[model samples]
Target chain A: MIPAKFDYIKASSLGEALTLLQEHGDEAKILSGGHSLIPSMKLRLATPSVLIDIGGISEMNTITEEGDEIVIGANCTHHQIATSDLVREHVNILSQAALCIGDIQVRNRGTLGGSLAHADPASDYPATVLACEATIVAEGKDGKRTIGANDFFQALFLTALQDDEIITAIRFPKVSQGTYQKFFQSASRFAVVGVAAIKKGDGVQIGVTGVSGVPFRATAVENAYDGTSSAAKHAMDGVDDIISDHFADEEYRSHLARVYVKRALEAL
Target chain B: MNISITINGKLVTHDIEPRISLSHFLREHLDLTGTHIGCDTSGCGACTVTLDGQAVKSCTVLAVQADGSEVTTIEGMAQGDQMHPIQEAFREHHGLQCGFCTPGMVMTAADILKNNPNPTEEEIRHGLEGNFCRCTGYHNIVKSIQHAAEQMKA
Candidate 1:
């Protein structure tokens, strides 16, 4: 399927991409892996006049250790993250979540920054980032700013990024223990209900996605934790906007969230 | 827009629109029809190809996005008259029925075996989760890849 006719410019660096984004405003869209945007474009859901291809930005493709956190470039592919030994050692749940996203072909081309920027409610990284207390870094004409994962995702297909800004990297705190449990949609391999639980000292940080319009940290469940499985009961305590599709109804998704939360807690 | 891609070890340049997908570029521009387009939505793995040595759904990849990258389609798998080991195994083990999905299956199989030279039956099945085979119920397809792994190892 061909997308709508649009101008394409390959940005070799981050500064060029930012400038292009500023030049086009909302008419231009940043192209990363193009797994999501291209498909949307082909379906005519997104018809940008120009595509700023940032797939060649080498600076935004490195995985490094910055003090206490593991800094992952926004352009890092799912296959890179899923197979990275550094990610496997620290912030392992991110790796776990990365592996659960789509299939091998999709993983080879999809990017972390692109996925988070797209902010699909069923996306895997949102759950992991929220649960791990990761920070998302966005750069614009002014400078770079970090937004906590809690405030990054605004709504379905919406993020805290401005039209002129692009995600440069995601910073995740090193965690020794974490688990991501997901009930997948059979055809697309998207999460029907995905719950990520990270053990933090005496408490657990729980993030839930695919059950609601916005991926959120399950604070009620974390607050209710007392070293037992009973805390998983509050998985949906404060969540109101539940998604109901043919793959999973609201009630079924709610049930799966609690069940997966319990399973994640048990695994932790 | 103008883009140059090393497809099947041959550098091909084209002046095309940005919306043209790599699958269309390979089929129409280069006349390399071995890469089949079963599902344009990236659901079925019929359009799988190796972009810089990694298997990706060509339908999801724009022709412009693959500029300066090395892409290997199913047409590049064989050496002249000799079929690739994976193709030979598929023929020997009856891996295909209608053969519409063969090109994609072969390309994905090459990637699978490339990553894991000695993959178990379960591993082969997991690696092939992206590719679909309605015929053979994947019984013979799995057997073909399993046999291919052994042949490649030896």
Candidate 2:
């Protein structure tokens, strides 16, 4: 299926991308890997007048290590993340989550920055990123600022990013014993309920996806971690306003969330 | 918009609408009908192609986005009368029944072998999940990839 007609502009660098975004305002949509945006465009769910193509911007296509954090450019594809040694060393949970996203084809072309920016409720990155306590960097007319993973996702298919803002990179802090476990939906392979558990010293952080309007850190589960299955099932006891869809009712989703959280914590 | 791409080791340029997907550009414009479009939403990997040596769903990629990139489709796998080792293995193992998903299967299998030359049956099965086959029950498909992996090693 062909998407509706739109002017495509390739940004030569980060500077050009920022300028184009500022000029076009809300009429322009930043195109990274185009996995999410192109599909929505074809379905007529999104019809932006202009597409600021940032896929070829070499500046925003890297994964590097600086001190204790791993900095990944926004254009870093899931395939890149999955195979990257730096990612494996710093935050293996992100790579594990990246591997579980869709299939090999999707992983090759889907970008981490794009996924986080799109903020799909079922995406794999948010859970791991949030669990790692990552920070997302954005560039706009006002220069640069970092948004914590906790405040990044606002709702389903929504983020805290402004219309003119573009995600530059995501920073994941190195942690000990991190893992992700997901119960996948049959056809799409999207997470039915995915949980990421990260262990840093005596403290454990947990994030849950596909059960809420947005990906959220399961604070109740994290705080209630007593290292037992009995305590794990009650992780969702206070997680109200769970999303209900055709694939799963709210009750089932909540149930899956707790089960997956227990499994993730066990793996960690 | 005018964009140029390297398809099957050939450089081609076109002045077309920005909306045309890489899958559509390959099939309609370049007449490389071997790349099939099953589910245009990137679910079915029928339109799978190697963009810069990585397998990607072409339907979810704009042709304009492929500018200055190299794309290897099913047409590039074989050399004239000589079929690629993957194709030979598929034929020998009875990997395909309908043959509708063969191109994508071969393409994805090629990528898997590229990444991991010798993959287990579980790995091959996991690799083929993106490219769906309604026929053969996937037993032969797994065999085909395993066979191809051995052949490539030889």
Candidate 3:
């Protein structure tokens, strides 16, 4: 499936990418891993006239430690994160979630920033990032800023990222214990219902995806946590707009959400 | 866009449109038809190829993205007349029925073995989740990979 005709510019650096983005404005689309973007373009869902390939930007491809947080570059592939010892030690839920995304071939090329920026409701990272309270770092011609995971995902296939801004890194706080449980949708391997649970002292934070139009932190489940799986029942207490498709209807998706949430919490 | 790529140890350059996918480039431009395209979408791994040591679905990757990268398709597997151990295993174990998904399965198997030289049955099954064989010959495919792993290890 061929995508629409477009001019491809391989940016040598982050600044060049930003300049190209601003110059092209609405006509441009940032090509990171291109796993999501390229497919969308092939389907004619996205027909940007200019593609600013940011794969050459070396600065946005590293994983580092910054004080209390493990800063992961946006361009880091899912395979890289899944195998990173630092990520495994600090925030293992991110690693677990990364391992659950797509498949080996997909994980080898797909980027975390691309996935988060695409903001697919069934994507695995959103739940992990929300559970970890990760911070997404964005850069643009104006400057740089960070958006917490809670505020990053706005709607289905929508993010808080501006047109010209690029996600450079994601900062995840150090967590000792966490787990990700996902019921895959078979063909695409996207989450039918994915739940990420983080154990913090006496409390827990839950993040759910694939059950609604927007991936969200399950504050109700967290609030109802009594050190037992019984709290998983509240997984859909406030999560309306439940997605129903041929893969799963609303009732089954909700049941899977609750089941996966319980599994994640029990695993923690 | 002008792009250069190393395919099966041969560096080739082409000035093509930016919309051409790596799978299309390999099949159309280079005439390397070993990399089949079952589902134009990324769901099917029939277009699987190694881009700089990583197994990726070539259909989803733009040809321009592969500039200056080393790509290994199924056609690159054999050495002279002697087939690669994995390919030989497939032939010996009768791993393929229709042979449509063989290239992708072989390439993905190579990647799986490269990463884990001694993968168990469960690991091989897990690694092969991307490639689909409509012929339902997965049992032999798994066996072929196990035999190939042993052959490569020895």
Candidate 4:
């Protein structure tokens, strides 16, 4: 099916992209790798007046190492991240999660930032990033501001980013070890229950996906781990309050969450 | 926009709408109908093509995005009048029945072989996860890929 007609602007630099966003306001949508946005446009779920293609912005496509964090440019494709030597050495969980996203074709075109910005509850990256306690950098008329992963994802298909802002990069703190475990729905490859666990010096963080409107942390499981109880069972215990629906009932998703959390913790 | 791309070893330029999908560009614009579009949603993998030496779903990519890239379609896989080893193996092993998914299946298999010259049966199955066949002929497809791998190695 053909998408609705809209003006296309290929921005060569970040400044040009941001200016276009400011001018178009909510009527503009930024296109990165076009893995997420293009499909939505084709389906008519999104009909923006202007499409600002930012894939050519070279500055937004690099993966760099800062003091104690790894900064991944928003436009970095999943294929690039999954095969990066730096990611493999420093943050393997992201690479592991990237490998499981859709299939090879989707991985070649999907970008890390687009996935996070799209804020799909079933996506694998949000939970992994939340578990790693990453920060998102958003650039707009107000300049730059960083939002924690937990604060970044506000609701289903929603983010803390303003309509006129563009996500520039994401920063992940260096962790000793981390792993992501996902149970994908067969056809769409969306997570039925995805878990990401990170081992920081003396603490562990657990993030659960495909079980709620937005990816959330399993605080009870973390608390249980701190108290020397079984982390997975405790995480499952906290599932009573989580929202549920047709894709996966509360009971089944809870059970899968426990199973995945245990597996992720074990792998970590 | 007038976009120029090297497709299947041929340099072609087309002025088309930005919304035109690469799959449509190859099939409708260039008349290289070997690349089929099974599902416009990018699920079927029937529109797979090598964009800049990397396999991507053509349905998901815009023609403008591939302007500066080299694309290898199923039409480009064969040499002169001879079939590629994968194609020959498929024919020998009866990898296709209806032939609807043949081009994409061959292209995806070629990509896997390019990366892994010797893939186990399970590896071949996992590599073809993106491509689907309604005839349930995956068993023979695996054999054909294995046979082609051996032929290429020889």
lDDT of 1 by residue, A138-241 (tens): 99988999999899989889999988899999999999999999999998899999999999999999988899989999999999999988989999998999
Interface RMSD of 4: 1.0
Chain B TM (all candidates): 0.97, 0.97, 0.99, 0.98
Residue B15 accuracy (lDDT) in model 2:
96
- Report how far off residue A123 is in candidate 3 (Å): 0.6
Off by over 4 Å in 1: none
DockQ winner between candidates 2 and 3 = 2
Cα distance off (Å), candidate 1, residue A96: 0.8
Off by over 4 Å in 3: none
Candidate 2 residue pairs in clash (backbone atoms < 3 Å): none
lDDT of model 1, residue A193: 91
Model 2 lDDT per residue over B70-143, tens place: 99999999999999999999999999999898899999999999999989999988988798887745899889
How much DockQ does model 1 earn?
0.84
In model 3, the Cα lDDT at residue A225 comes to 93
Candidate 3 lDDT (Cα, 0 to 1): 0.93
Which 10 consecutive residues of model 3 chain A have the lowest summed lDDT? Answer: A231-240
| Fraction of the reference Cα-Cα interface contacts (below 8 Å) that each candidate reproduces | 0.75, 0.89, 0.77, 0.55
Per-residue CA lDDT of model 3 for A169-197, tens digit only, reads 99999999999999999989999999999
Q: Report residue B33 deviation for candidate 2 (angstroms).
A: 0.8
